[model samples]
Every structure is written in structure tokens, then in C-alpha cells.
Target: MIVTRDLTKRYGRTTAVREVGLAVREGDRYGLLGPNGSGKTTLIRLLLGLVFATGGDIEVLGLPVPRRVRDVLPSVGALVEGPGMYPHLPGRTNLELFDAAGPGGGRRDRRRRIGEALERVGLAGIDRRPVRAYSLGMRQRLGLAAALLRRPRLLILDEPTNGLDPRGIREIRDLLTELHGEGTTVLLSSHLLTEIEAFCDRVGVMDGGRLVLQDDLATLRAPTGRVVLRTPDADRALALLDGRVEGRDGDRLTVRHRAPDDLNAELVTAGVRVRELAAERRSLEQVVLDATTTTSADRADRAGGDPA
Candidate 1:
């Protein structure tokens, strides 16, 4: 439902997005992750037609942006940056205003849609409360409700989990999962890798104004299997492996390698009795940090600076 061809965006002397290409199919729960100033927001804005790209092409829902933004926007809903709401207005009134502005069939239909949107965001009971009285999390949910009023085909959300408590985060996660299951395409952007990992099927990692990696979360995670093993011969095991050990404890060692079963067998064959063995999975934070740090370090090395 979304495609970009050599999408490039420049701000004055600096290029915010450089030759980035992306394709998100229908019903995709895709995450776009990056550090600050990493061009993630720039790419999203380009796709939304909020900002024009200096070079390349962008299409959303099979229609070219800028050219078809007017026609396509009705089918798309986005909560970019943060929630926008009238501080003085009640949450319900906020939805009512949006519903009025939207292309609803009539007043009753608009109210019905508004009610459904508020309920879907889990703000059904307290919509009458003023937005200024609501917490940051509530305002964010209200923003989501407004976006949902149109029953959009594509939902582009940036930092959707910001300011949310654990329970609120879970609710939003469940809501997004349900939306994707119902054939709604979602493009979620956030700096939090854990959130993205939990909900996104595919992810794109951005650094230095370019997309450095894009793949299924399962594939990104498959290569990082490891195991923590404790043994009386921990020193001997590390010596035998020739520095494959990552961490050293009193009598335990963390080994960074795939296929823990094979490694355990090797240890046993080498006559090292394993007292305790537990498999390890790399957290999304670890994977994201590894990718960004590697890229940043490479760039720093090329420029003759400290390696991060």
C-alpha cells in the first residue's frame, strides 16, 4: 500500500533522507526505527505530502503524493509527531470537530463514527472530560481516536507509545494488532526498539540519512541466538573456544553463538561439565543498538573520529 523510489529529501546543505526506498504491503505492521536526526520523520512527512522531496518519487495507496494527496488523504489517517487537540475542548468535542470536518454522510453517521473511534481507543467513558485535564497519555489516545474516525485504510503513526504507561502501551499494541488483522496497513515509527519488536512484523532501520537495514523481525533475530552456561571449568571453556565468550562471571560465562545445542555438545565433548545452561535471545534494543552503533562507528572511522 506504500512505495517509494529513490526517495530523497534535503534541508539546505544537509540531506535528511538520501535515496531511501521503502515498500509496505497491505496489512503490514511495519516499523520504521531510527535515532534522532536519522531521517525517519523526514521520510514519513514526504510520504504524507507535508513536505516535498527534493528528488525521487513517493506513492501512498497506489497514488503519487502531492499530486494525489488531496484524493488519497481521505483514505489515510496519520498521527505524526504528537497529538494535536484543543486544550480547552473536551475530548469528545475534539472528536466531534474532526468528525464534522471529515467527509461523513450526515450528522448521525459522523456521531456514530466518532463514538466508535473513541471506544476503539479505550476512551469511551471519559470523552466528556476536557483535554487539558487529561494526562499526556489520554491526549495521545484521543489523537488516535480522531485519526480512526475516518476508518482509514492506512494508519501512519510516529511515537505512538510516547507518554503511555505499561497498561496503555499494551492497549495500543493490542489495538494495532487488531487493526492489522482486519486488513489495515500500519506504518509505525518510534525510537523504542522494544515496542517495534513487539508489534511489528517487518522493520526498517535508518541511520545517517539512509535506510541501512530492512527485514522481518524474525530474520533479524534469528542470527543472534546465544546461551548462558555455568560450569566448574568456565576458564577452560573460554580458553578452548578462543574468546567466543562474551561475559565472565565468578563461575558462569555468556557465550555469543548460534545453535546452543551444538555448543553444549562441544563443551561436553571437551570434558567440561555444564552445571547450568540457558538459551538467550537478543532483545530488540540490543539488535537496534548493534546496527546503529556499527553504522555510526564505521562513519566515524572513515571521518577520523572516535568510534561509537
Candidate 2:
């Protein structure tokens, strides 16, 4: 439903996004992952037409962006920074106002959609309360409700669970799953690796303003076929497992591709007692870190910029 080619964005001499490309299909939950200054937000802004790209092409939902963004926006719902609203207004009123300005529809339909959205986000009971009185989590949910007011075909959320407690986070997760079940494509950018792993099937990793990797989540998060051994005699164990040592963490050692049984047996034979031995898999966090290793040059390359 979204495509980009050589997508570039710049502020003066520094490039925030460079030569990034993606093919996000329908019925997919695509996660955008990156580090502190990795341009994930900048890219999202470009996709939303909130900011024009400096160069290259973008097609979202079969329409060229900026030019056709208005046509496609009816089918798109986005919760970017936060739900922009009047704090003095009641939550329900806020939603009503948003619906009036939402995709064109009948008044009765808009009212029904508003009710459904509030109900869907668990704000039906307390939507009468002023938004100023709502907790952070409540505000977040209310923002989500506003996004769903139009029953959008595409939901683009940036850190949708930012202010919620664990339970609230879970509720939002379930809500997203429900939307996906009904065929709403959800695209989100977040630092919450576990949450993304739980919901997203595809992922795009960004670094130095470039999309370094984009793939099926399972393939990208695949195990490294390694084993880790935690032994008291780490030094001796390291010596015994010479050629197999991948790396070490404190008293723990990562031994390459060898079976635990083989490592255990070898350690025993070499008189180095093993405390803990288990198969190891590269974690999502590790994969992200490996991909986005920032160097002095990468930092220097960034111009401390955000899209207008």
C-alpha cells in the first residue's frame, strides 16, 4: 500500500533520510525501528505528506504524495506526536469535533462512528470528562479513538503505547490486533522491540537516515545457532573453547554453533566446570543494535534537523 524509491530528505548539508525504499503491502503490520537520531520520524513525516521529500518518489495507497495526499488521507489515520486537542473540552466532544472534520459522511454515520470509536478505545464511559482531567494513558487512548473515528483503512501510529501502563499497553495491543483482523493495515514506529515482535510480521530498520534492512520479522529475528555457557572458570573455559568463542559477557561466554552437549562434554574433559549451558538466539534488540551502530561519522553526518 506504500512504495518509495531513493527517498531523500535533507536540511542544509546534512541528510536525515537518504536513498530509503520500502514496499509496505496491504494487511501487513510493518514496524519501523531505529536509534535516537535515526530519522524514523522524519521518514514517517515524509510518508504522511507532513513534510515534502527533498528528492525521489513516493506512492501511498496508489496515489502520488503531496499532490494526492488529500485523496488518500480519508483512508489514512495517524497518531503521530500526540492527540492534538483542546484540554478544556470533554473527550467525547473532542471526538465529535474531530468527526465533523473527518472524512465526509452523513451526520448519523459520523455519530455512530464516534460512539464506536470511543467504545472501541474504552472511553465510552468517561468520554464525558474533560480531557484535562484524563490521565496520560486515557489521553493516549482518546487520541487513538480520534484516529479510528473515520474507520481508516491504514493506521500509522508512532509510539501509540507511549504513556500507558502495562495493562493499557496490552489493551492497545489487542485493539491493534483486532483492527488487523478486520484488514486494517497498521504501520508503527517504536523502540519497544518486544511489542513490535509480538504484533508485527514485517520490519524495517533505519540507520544513518538509510533503510539498512527490511524483511519478514521471523527471518530478521532468526536464531544464530549459538550456545552460551556460564561457568565459574570463565578464563579456563575461554581457553578450552578457543576456536568456538564468539564473544563473552562477564562470566558468560558465547560459543559458536556447537551443541550444548558438545560444549559441556568438552568443558568437562578440559576440567573447566560449566554452571549454565543453553542454546542462544540473537534477540531483536541485538539485531537492531548490530544494524544501527552509530559512528562518529554517522553522528557528524546528521544535521540536528527535523522536518518542518
Candidate 3:
């Protein structure tokens, strides 16, 4: 649904994005992971045609960006940094104004569309209170409702769960899952590693204005050729698999085994009382940290200049 080739963006002397080749497929819940000053927001703006690239190409929904952004934008909904709203107006009013300003959806169904959008974001019973009176989470939900007002085919979101509690975050995740199931392509950038790990199918990591890694989440987090075994018979298991055991702590043993099931069966058959056994896998945090060379603060200090 979105593709870029050697995409570059520069701000005066500083490069915000450099040589980024991004690929987001249709019906994909792709997560863009990066630290501050990593150019994630800049990259998103480049893809949405809000900021023109310094070099390279961009395509969204099969159309060249900026050149055909108008054609592509009708099907694309985005929330970057945050949503803009009229502080004096209620949430419903804010959505109504946004819908009217947009290109798609006629006036005949505008009211229904507004209500449905609000309901989808869990603000169905909202009263006529100004947006300034709403909590941070409520405003966040209102922004999401505005994005969904036009039933966009592609959702490009940045820090989508910025001001929400755990429950609200889970609600948004479930809502995105439902949309993905129904054929909407989602590209969301977030610093929340756990959220992305649990929700996204594909992931891309950015650092120092470059896309350092891109792959399916499962591939990036493949098993680490080891198993973690918890058993009361730790001594017996260690004796039986002395050569294969790598590390041990109390009743838990880290065994250098390729197949966890085979290891479990071997232990059970040997009269070792096994409590739990599972394959060891690299967590998303490990993958991201291994890919990125610098922290946001380190990058900022090294650059000694502008923010990406």
C-alpha cells in the first residue's frame, strides 16, 4: 500500500531521513519503531506528502506522492503528532467539522458517519462539553474518531496511543485488528515496544535517519536455538543432559536444544519432574536494540544541530 526508494529528506544542513527504502503491503499491520530524533515522524510526513522529499521516490496506494497525493489522500487517514481540534467545540462538533472539510462522504450521511466514528472510539455518550474540558485520553480518542470518519483504506498513525491508559490502548489495538481483518492497511509508528510486539505482523526499525531493519515480526523474533526448562528435578536433568546444558539457576536450566518438545519428552521419560519447558526466543526489545547503534540523546549530541 506504501513504498519508498532511497527516500531522503534534509533540513538545511541536517538530514532528517536518508536512503530509506520502505515497503508496506496491503492488509498489513506494519509497525515503525524508532527513538526520538530517529526521523520516524519526518518519514511519515514524507510518505503523506506533507513534506516533500529531498531525493528519491514515494508511492501510496499505487500513486506517486505529492504529484498525485490529492488522489491518494482521500483513501488515506493519518494522525501525526496528534489531531487538531477546536478547543471550544464538543467532540461531535469537531468530527462534524472535519468531515465537512474532507472530500469524501456526502452531507446526507454526515450525521450518521460522525456518530459512528465517535461510537467506534468509545465516545458515544459524550455530552456538549468543550474539547478543553476533556481528558487527555478522551482527546486522543476524539482524534482517532476523526481519522476514522471517512473510512480510510490506509491508516498512517504516529504515537497513536500517546495519552491513553492500558485499557484504552488495548481498545485501540482491538479496533485496529478488526480494521486489518476487513482489509485496511495500517502503518503505525510507536515507541511502545510491547504494544507493537503484540499487535503488528511486520516491523521496520529506523535510526540516524535510516531504515536499519525491515522484516516480518515473526522472522525477526525467531527461536534462539535454545530452550528454558523449569523442573524440580533440576539436578537429575542436568546430569542426564550434561553436555547440552548451557546455563542454570536454581530449578531453571537453559538447554542448548533445537526442539523444545523433544527435550521435554526426554526429560519426562527420564523421570525428571518438569514444571515448564519452552523455546527461547529473542524479544522485540533485543532485536531493536541490536539493530540500532545510537540512542536518541546520543544522536542529538553527535549531530550538534537540528532535530529530525
* TM, every model: 0.84, 0.81, 0.94
lDDT of 1: 0.86
For residues 257-301, what per-residue lDDT tens digits would candidate 1 score against the true structure? 777889989999999989988777666777788888998899999
Top-scoring candidate (lDDT):
3
**Which candidate, 1 or 3, has the higher lDDT?**
3
Candidate 3: stretches off by over 4 Å: 294-308
Candidate 3, residue 55: lDDT: 98
Model 2 quality (TM-score): 0.81
Of the candidates numbered 2 and 3, which has the greater lDDT value? 3
Model 3 poorest 10 in a row by lDDT: 293-302
lDDT string for model 3 (51-168, tens) is: 9999999999999998999889879888888888999998888888888887675789999988888898899999999999999889888898888888899999999899999999
Each candidate's lDDT (Cα)?
0.86, 0.86, 0.91
